[model samples]
Structures are given as structure tokens and as C-alpha cells.
Target: MGDVTTIRRDVLTLPVADVGPDNPLPPLCPPDEIHRPDERDGEGLPRDMARQIGYGRLRSLLPERLRDGYGRSRAPRAVDTLVIENDRLRATVLPGYGGRVVSLVHKPGDRELLYRNPVFQPADFALNGAWFSGGIEWNTGATGHSTLACAPVHAARVTAPDGGDMLRLWEWERLRDLPFQVDLWLPDGSDFLYAGVRVRNPHERAVPLYWWSNTAVPEDRRVLAPADEAWHFGPERRLRRVPVPVHGGTDRTYPRRSEYPADHFYELPDGRRRWMAAVDADGRGLVQTSTDVLRGRKLFVWGTGSGGRRWQQWLTEPGTEGYCEIQAGLARTQLEHVRLEGESEVAWLEAYGPLTADAGTVHGTDWAAACSDVEERLERRLPRAGFEEAYKAWRTAADTEPGELLATGSGWGALEVLRAGHSLPGTPFDESALGDAQAPWQDLLRSGSLPEPRRAGPPGETLVAPHWRDLLETAPAHPHTEYHLGVAQWHAGDRAQAVRSWERALGLAPSQWPLLRCLAVADLEAGHRERAADRYTDAFDDLCRERRDDGEAWTAATAALGREAVAALLAVGRTAPARSVWERLRPATRRRGRFRLIEAELLLAEGDRDAARAVFDAGFEVADLREGAEAVGALWSRITDEPLPERYDFRMRPSGGGGA
Candidate 1:
């Protein structure tokens, strides 16, 4: 162990000038507009999933009339910020700005490792439209501008177990009703700092959860991770697996902007190799490692010399060079639901710092060889006691049977794999010999290794029955058995049977939204508009009831489903039912100061000019309502033959306008 005397803390501030609010109110999207949340349907995204996945829709709907521009307000200047350093490394955390790690420097070389933003500026880039770039952005709760991301958190400095300094930042996630805390511990002599995160759910009901740490490094650096294959998302939204480290005859681990921006995923198969790095050619850079809890690695960069990349630079700062994100996620990717049981808490530790290549002969541009160099350096730089013990523990955990780990409560975040309704291989036993099939089939279902349905062809009823029939015959009580049976039934084009299976699954898991959503979709596709609307509403109500304090979640759901449900009713010319949905969602929408334009449009469609004007006045900005204003104006002109209200000024028309 090294001496504890070397740990120190200092305060420095990076001067910030407020850019004004978002300027020129953005337009309102039609209530029924379909926006795909992810490459897929976002079937079961966990809480705290990254904001980029469909959460941005919430912000796009709420128009920001005026935006603050960072360029004109102030010049770059040094200001007070928080710093914690040991003998080997220095790390700075901005307490005033969402507790982001604004800087991390290697003490030996006096080199800055993190991509530090030159100006403290924010743009409407996040889901809820307020995010600053660079550094490490800790995301928690269900995506978007997490209530905690931009808000000030509770910060404190305390002594670590080894008598070193530790900085603790914590916040209560108001939206999900969870409390999350992080401790940044810089030991006296270690080259790396440990970031320990803890999230606790106080409620008795299990809730879906998500957590990710996004670290920004210079774009010139190469990234490396231990993985055999990578997932390639095609243009048509299919995932293809290719060998990692090298893909398409190129080394993908190296950072270079692409012609088109894309996100690449590498699965950390087991605990032993759950680490990634951003390094230069000489094998010198930062390495990030985490416990099995954070098993996903992502490499993302804005395409080189693209308009979007240029715009990003301009939004963050002028002369801002490009940077790539090396992200560590709690799961393989965002949006997959990970259940956090009631009153349970999950914790994990992540560490990253500088690596100095030594002893190893430099090999030709091989990522594996580079990783070996870093590993050797890590073994030498980390104290024997800490490094040896952690390595042993990780190896032991990694070596454990994957199924045994699940049984022992070790793979809590990976429960998504256990979701029922997956398809399975057909048994050799004859279909008439149902009694002989049950015992063997139940074991397969219990193993959670059933293959997912192939989307290549239309659902085949004959193919769907054999696998699930055996399980249902053998284990009728298993909800997952019913769930999988339902999915198979749906695929086979047996809608009635599929609904029956889903109903059974719901009986077993009442709050499970996927089952409800699947049923609703089936209803909608079958032209049962009223039934579909009711089912959608029920699922929406269940979601809101579970997360009552989360208005953003409510807003997201309203935009994604509630509005669609209402539109489905309207599409079928069912005005009374549509009005009911509008009324039920009015409180939350009004609280967010949105959707009044849609409400007005609905009213105008019904020829209720007086009521439409009332809602329009409540929701529209007198100066920036634009097309919504004109639509309302035209309707009132036709109905009442009156001049526009004085508040409505159409003198300076924008290039275009449209109906709400």
C-alpha cells in the first residue's frame, strides 16, 4: 500500500456565461406522428436508458421559443472548479454543472486525457433539450434530461477506507422515485480512480432501470475492448454479428470519423474481459474497467467532416475539435428492460486512468497486443494487494456458470434474457404424444436459452405450436411459458389464440406493459380501434400509476402512445372517445405546457371555435405560434367573421407555415 499523505483536493471554476433560452419557437409535431424510439420498437427499454433513444421526442414536442447562444456572451476564462488528485493522477468534477468530470490529467506527463470543453455551454441536444458536451456525463433514471443531470446534486468530500480522499455526489431521482449516489475515490498512490455507483428503489414494486457512464476522449485516439464479435445494425434495422477488433477488413477499434455517423456495439461476454480503452498508437492512454454489472461497451463518433459534426462543434464551442464517446452501460445496450425489484439496491465500481507502456515490445498495430501492453502496465502500476485481489475476484466470477450466476442473483441486470414468449426448437416427439413432451420441454424453458423468433417470414401457426405446446402442457403455471406461447401464436397469424395467451400472461404479470402493448397492437392491426384505444389507455394508465411522480415519463408516453390512441379513435371518427383521452391526459400535458395546439386542432375539427380559441390562448405563444396561430385564425375567421386578436401578429412570416 502507498502512503495516504499524497491525496489532495482543490477548487477551480470554469467561467460560464448563460446563453439565452432557445430562440424562435420550434414547431409542434402532429399528435399522431410515429417516431421510432430505437432501431427497434423499444419493446421494453429499462428506466434510465440513454436519452438519445426516443426521449428526445419529448423535447421536440415542447417548443423552446428562445434559446441562449454561448458565442456572444463571454470569453473563455479560468474559474473555480473542484479537483481531487493523488500522486499519479488528477481529476476535476464540476459540482455546479451536473457533477460532470470536466478534466482528468496524468500527473507524470502533465497530460490531459479527457476532452475538456473550452466553454461551458449547453444546447438542446438532450432528450429534454438541455445538455453540455465533453467530459463524463452520468445518466440515470429513464433517459432524456434526467432530473439530476443538469440540476445541482448533493456533493461532499470524505475519507476513503485507505485514508485517501473521496468525492461523493448523490441525488434523489424524482421521476423514478429512486436515489442514486456515486463516490469518486482517488487512492493515495493508485494510477486509477474508482467510481462506485449505487441505486436503490424504495418502492415494493419492481421497476425497470437503466444506468450508463459516457466518457469523451479525443477523436484521434483508438479504442479497444475484449470482444470476439460486434453487432452491425443494417440500414433496414437488422442486427448482424461480425468479428470484433477487425470488421469489414478494417480495425474498428481505431477511432476515425465515418462517412455516415453510426454507433457500434461490442458485447462484453464475461466478467474477465469487461474493460475498454481509448489510447494512442504507442499504447499510452486511459483504460476503463468495471465490474460485471456494467457489461456493455459502445464506440460512437460523429462522422468526419459532416454537417452534423460541424453543427455539434459550433453548438458546444468554436474551434472545438472532434471527440468520440467510449461508453459503458449497465446492459448490452440501452432500452432493454432490466428489472430492479422492490426495495432492492444494485451497486458497481468502475475505474479508469492513464496507462504508460513499459517492458512489452511494440507490436504492429494489433489491438490485442496493445491491450496486453496496457494490462502489463496496469499489473505493474496498481498495488499488488488491490490488483491481485480484484483480478482473482473477477476471474472467479467470470468462470462461474452463466446460469448459476443468474440463480445466485449475480446477473440481475441481465434478466431481460429471461423474459417469456421466446420461440424454441421443436421437439422430436410426435405432436399427438403431448404427454411425452412436457417434462423435457419445461427444462428448456427454465434454462432461458430459447431462440428468439426469426423475422424472416410470416408467422406460421404449425411452427409456433410444437415448441410452446409442450411447455404449456408441462408447465401451465409458468407465465413466461404463456408469454412465449402468445408470441409464437401471434407469429403464426392466429390473432385470437395470441390474445388468449397474452391475457393469461397478463393475469400472471399485471403490470407488464409489453404484454398489454402487444395486445393493443394486435387489436389496432385487426381494425378494433376502440378496443385498441382502451388497451393502450390501460397500459398508459398502468405506466403512469407506477411512475406517478414522473411527468416526463407521462409526457413521453403521451406522445408515443396516448396521442396515438386518441388519434386511432379520431381516425375511426369516434369523437367522444377521443375527447375522453384528451381530457384524461390534459392535466399532465398542461403541466408540461404542451399539446394545447393539438387540443385546439381537435376542437377545430369538431367546429368548436370558441373552445378551440380558449385552448389556443392557453397554450400558444402570442408572438411565435406560427402555423398553429394561422390555423386557429383561419378557423375562427370562417366561424365568427372576426378580425384576428391583437396578440396575433402575422406581419413577419417565416418561409413556411402549416396547420397544427
Candidate 2:
């Protein structure tokens, strides 16, 4: 047989002999006639009665009390049996529970099984099962009440080639004699699977309960949840970044692909539900599943990123590919009736199948196509939306109190809207109309809001804030704001103002390493070696702490800061201290191409010309790592005692010899 084939019939074919008469056949088993032991000699007198049994004694093993409890007292009994015969496999499904076959088999040859009952162990549930530990607890003293709550929870399971005998089962006892119901299914046969729950108020009196799905999957997997926005929380659990709506509307979607590794809990938009898929890159077929349709279900996706967060292992396996499962239920609560009621409605699922490797690629392409179509529809609808009226309002807003309205925070929205307007084929706001907001425009330019700040004359010259000073004043103060303001002041020949701004920033929040480094350099320029040394110490301390806290961010920040620090220290004859700091930093931080030249400088300072030459030689081996234009110019200045290169030239061509 070829590697790929599609079977036409819903039922699969299985080898009869492969199945164990004592145990249930796998879901994938194909159907065919096979020999059996003595027919009915054990219970009945008939000798031919046993040859037709497919699931063997499994059908009889299900407790009759359990079956009666699941249905009406006098309802017609339904046959729950697995049959294998004539190259076709079949299982009888009961009607009461959505007519779903709780136990299903594919072909006899297929080794996948739909359900199995494994012995329960608390330790196994604690360590291997999901929803056993650290979840919201609920207890109802035979009093039925309905309540819904939400809490962060986790669950996991491992499926290997061996241990087919082990199976997982969960049971919920009714406290208030309310109807306990659950809908479980493996919707996707690949990488991800999900279970959804819904609780109904069967009784006239209200019920309360706490519920959650402690769902777990193999470590080292990733999750994809549909999100319209995201939020960031700092170490203190304080809101770092507010929920910023994913810029593209719901219709304007992008492939939910992550460029960087992360594990985070993303909330879906209110009123709209979303599905999540867990993926293992190295797995065979994607194990996908989803929740059953219920009156109300809230979806959530939580996992870790490539970074070493506690939950990252669930989303990403260390050496091998992993798996992920989605658990859906009522939120979390503490009340007894509430917990019991919630448990009645809890949903769980398990799926084992090979995942298609190119599923993500296919899904991503489809998303892109859909988004393009949506954008086109939006574009067609724009002409009828009274664009002229909106443009007039925008222009009016831009004219009056132009500075305040176009200030830092306010202008960002307006800027985005205005840019969007420009992209449209027929926009009401003419270029000249946009230019009419010049006062606000000048305010932004004067405040250094533009990408590049305007240059000013020599030192000691009288200076004034640009025409848009009010607009600049309205902009919020961020860490970079003061730094940029200082740069503007320096260019305008107000050295004192620049220094004061930097100092003010440092006083406000001393842990800002970039500002500290800048302050240190300014001190060095002013011949304040002692002050510079103190500033350097502060910067080094903050960076070192950050490095120890998070290696990646620390490496990035250090690489950027270390280069400047090395140069400044060398200028101030503090090579020894600089060298010591460099040593403490990670090798990844120093091996950057930019640092190679710095290494040469440090060697030259130590009077090791050969070592410096070797560093330069290594740098030359990488074509792009050759000495930067500004560095060469600096060397020429040192050799010939010529005037320094122009500021604009220096800025335009920076020494790009740094590690990233």
C-alpha cells in the first residue's frame, strides 16, 4: 500500500485475530470473521453462541446500575456492543446521550481505541492527570444550586507506544439530585483536542457551584487561541500594558503564528467565542479536538512560550515534540452546590492520532485569504460611510487646541487614522488640509516627536522651545521622553537644561540603565570622574540584576549598553573596571562583531598589539564586520589631528560594530 490513502466508507476494516477477546478492540480495528473459543459453554449450554461477539465480554462488564442511572427508569434498553465482521467494524450508540457512541472502533487492524477504563490512583491523577491539583474546589451537601466561576487551572497526560492498558476516567456524584450531564469528544483527530461544558438551571430555584478543567498536555508544545487583543502583566501582577486590540479587526486576521516563544493566557472578545488548537511540530498527525455545542461556553487558551516560564513546558517539550489539550467548564467558585452543579456540566476529551505536518501552513494560508477578502469588502464599504463628514470633524479637531488635541497620546490615534485615510483610494482630507494643522505639527517637531530632531547652532546660543511647545508639553512623559528632550536641549546649545533633564529622570526612577549610562557619559564629558564612576556603578548594578533575572533580555540590553560603556571607560582611563564588568557579562554579549573592535581597543590599551591585531583579523574575516565609517574617521582624526567628522555624517553612518 502507498503511504497515503483515503477510505471511502465510514467504517474501517480490521484483522479479527489481532483483537483480544478479553479486552476491547482498538477503534481502528477493521471488521472480519475470526475464530472464537467455546461458544456458550461457560454460561449457557449452546456451543455456537460466542463466535459472533466482537468486543467480547466488555459489553457485559459495564455495570447495569450505571446504565440505569444514565437513563429513565422504564426506558427501552439499548444495546451497547462492538461488532467486527466481514471487513466492517460497528459499535451500537445509545440515543439518550446525544446518540453518541461513547465506545467506538474503526478497523480491527487500527490500534487506536476510543475509550478504556483504568484503575484510579490519587498520585497518578496528581502528577499525570489534568484538573486534579491546584484547581478551584467545590462541595455541595445534597443541596442543588447553580453557580459559575473561573480560575487558572492546568492538566496533563502522556500517551506512549506502550501501556495501552492504562485509561483515564472521571466521575461526579450528584449532591442535590440534579441532573449530572457531560459531553466529551475528540473533535480533531490531530495535534489538538478540546472539551466544552454548559450548565442549565433545571430547577426553579437557583443553584451555585465552582468548576474548572485542569487540562494538561505533554510538555514542549505550543497553543493557538483566537485573540482580538492581548495584555501584559509585570512581575508585581500589575497591569503593564493595557488590553490593546489587535490592530486588525476581527475580519482582518493574520495567521495566529508566533514569531517569538511565549506562554500566556489570552482572553477572547466579549460575546464572541473562540476555539484553540495545540500543536506538536514533530508529531505525526495533529491531534485536534473541540468542545460540544452547549448553551453557553467560554473559551480560554493558556500555555508557555520558548522562554522558561513555569508553564512553558506544557506548550513546548524540551527535546521531543509535545501535545496540548483544551479543558472547558464553568469558571471557579468555592460554594458546595455551585461546585457540584459545575461538575455536572464539566466537559473533558482525549484524542490520539497522527497530525498532518502542513496543517498550520494550510490554516495560515486560508486565514490570509480570508483576511484579504475582508479587507476588500471593507474597502468597498468605505465610500458609503460619509468619509467627508468624518474628515471635517478630524480637521476641526486638528485646528482648535491643536497642541493639546495632537499631544503625545492623543496624536497616536489620529496619526494612525490619518495614515489609514492616506491608504484609501479616495480620501476627503487633502494633503493641504492635513498641512493646515501646522501649529500642532510644529509642536510635535519641536518636542522631538519626529524620527530625527532638528539641529541647532553652537553652544551658549539663546534657545527657545519650537512653536509646538504646547503640543510637546501635552505629550506624556515616558522614560525615553526625557532622554529625547535632553538630546533636543543639547542640540539647541542648552547644556545645563539637558543635564538637568537627565538628572530629573534618574531621580524619578533610578533603575533605568540607559539613562544612567547617559548621565555617566555626560559627567565624564564635564570632567567629573567621581560622579561618572558612581553613575557607571548604578548602571552596571541594574544591568547585572536584569541579566541574572532574564538571560535573553539581559543579553540584548547589555550588548547595546556594554559597547558604549567600554568606549566611555576607555576614554576616561577606567579600562580595568570596564574589563571586569565585561568579564561578568555572558560570552554571547561580548562575541558580537561590534565588540571585536572594542576588544582590539582594550588589547591596545594593555599594549598587546599582537592580540589587538588578531582581534582585527578575526573581525575582517566577516565582511560586514569591517571597521565602520565613523570608526575609521575617528582613527584618522587620532592619527592626523584633523577636525572631527560632522555631526550629521556621524549620525548618518553609525559604527554598526556591535553584538545584537
How would you encode candidate 1's per-residue C-alpha lDDT over 1-660 as one tens digit per residue? Answer: 243523234556454555432322122221221212335534443334433344322212221112222222345555445677776777887665567888888877998888887776555444334467788878776532343444455555544545445666655453344566666777567778778777777566776676778898887777777766765442223345567666777766655635434456686565454677787666577778776778778786565533335434544564777788888887666434367888787777788888656323322455567666666666566643564455344332221211100001111111111323212111011222233213334345576333322321111111133434454535544555565566655654566987888888787664455566668777887788778777776766665555344443334444445556566666667677667667767474543322555576578667787887776455453211221124445544554555555433231122213211
Per-model TM-score, in order, reads 0.54, 0.27
Model 2 Cα RMSD, Å?
A: 30.6
The stretch of ten residues in a row with the least summed lDDT in candidate 2 is: 63-72
Candidate 1 is scored at a TM of 0.54
Q: Per-residue lDDT for 355 in model 1?
A: 65
Error of 2 at 80 (Å): 56
In model 1, the Cα lDDT at residue 534 comes to 74
Candidate 2, residue 381: CA error in Å? 42
Query: Per-residue CA lDDT of candidate 2, range 400-449, in tens?
Result: 21111100111221332243332211112223223322333444544545
lDDT of each: 0.54, 0.31
Q: How much lDDT does candidate 2 score?
A: 0.31
